[model samples]
Target: MSVHFEERSGVVPCKTPWGSWYQTMEEVSIEVNVPPGTSAKEVKCELGSRRVELVVRGQQVFKGKLFGTTVEDEATWTLEDKCLIRIVLMKANREAGNCWGSLLDGQYSADPWVQDQMQRKLTLERFQRENPGFDFSGAEISGNFAGGGPDFSNLQR
Candidate 1:
């Protein structure tokens, strides 16, 4: 797990129905890259064995699952605010190998979710480049930008 991120500023850790997560209220510089033809409304997320069910204000929106080898896990979807994705992984003392693995030597091709995540990340990078001074603190589905956001309901096929 080699996750490299710049020092985030004004970030506060918060908890949701799924688990504890963190976000920054300030415009922190996050060096990232996205794929081509991807829009800003998407986010590429990678997780472990844990799978999450998305809910908004107590309403169910989407369900998620992780795919990969026993050592690595990966998934992707559009970014949304106020939407929580619950990850369900553990069962009967058995661990689901979804999020922990060596990505360097792991399988990265032929995984639909991984591709989606990559596209979403690229979209985010483009969004950051376009909006040089805006904070991505509240970029979830609930929040709306001046131009437009990712169409979570509609994904590229």
Candidate 2:
């Protein structure tokens, strides 16, 4: 239940056992960490019934699960001194929202979608870093292979 961070995106997962989740009269706030120099446009957040996914640089990084309370779609995020992304989620059931367990203490892992997208994004980012000045965008798959099996179609987009 320790807090963990993915170095690639510098994402500090929310709702981990390490995070503090508390509810006020109308909202629940969770603190997260993002990379420095992360512009507002570079970060994309998606809220589901129980999970919150964050997409940065076209990479799915942090996916946090809200165990008890249902969160509203509209969320507010503010930047801290050293690139901390604080997200406050609106509680669907505000009156009894305080009846939850400890917020911090469980493993925080991204969802399957985040895993898939992050794999591709990290691979591309690594390739770009290793091969500077290479036109990765123009690179083509010759379509001629031994097995003719899975290709980089998923990695393309």
Candidate 2: where is the Cα deviation over 4 Å?
1-21, 80-82, 102-157
lDDT of 2 by residue, 1-157 (tens): 4221122233212245324343333455666566777777777877665667766668766666765555566667766764666677765654321322333224344445443333333343334444565633333333222222234545743
Tens-digit lDDT track of model 1 for 5-79: 213222232222333332111111112223344343443344334343433334443344423222223233343
- Backbone clash tally for model 2? 5
- For every candidate in turn, the CA RMSD to the true structure comes to 18.5, 17.9
TM-score of 1: 0.23
Best by lDDT: 2
Among these predicted structures, which one has the highest TM-score?
A: 2
Candidate 2: pairs in clash: 1-105, 17-104, 17-105, 17-106, 18-105
Worst lDDT 10-window in candidate 1: 23-32
The 10-residue segment of model 2 with minimum total lDDT is: 3-12
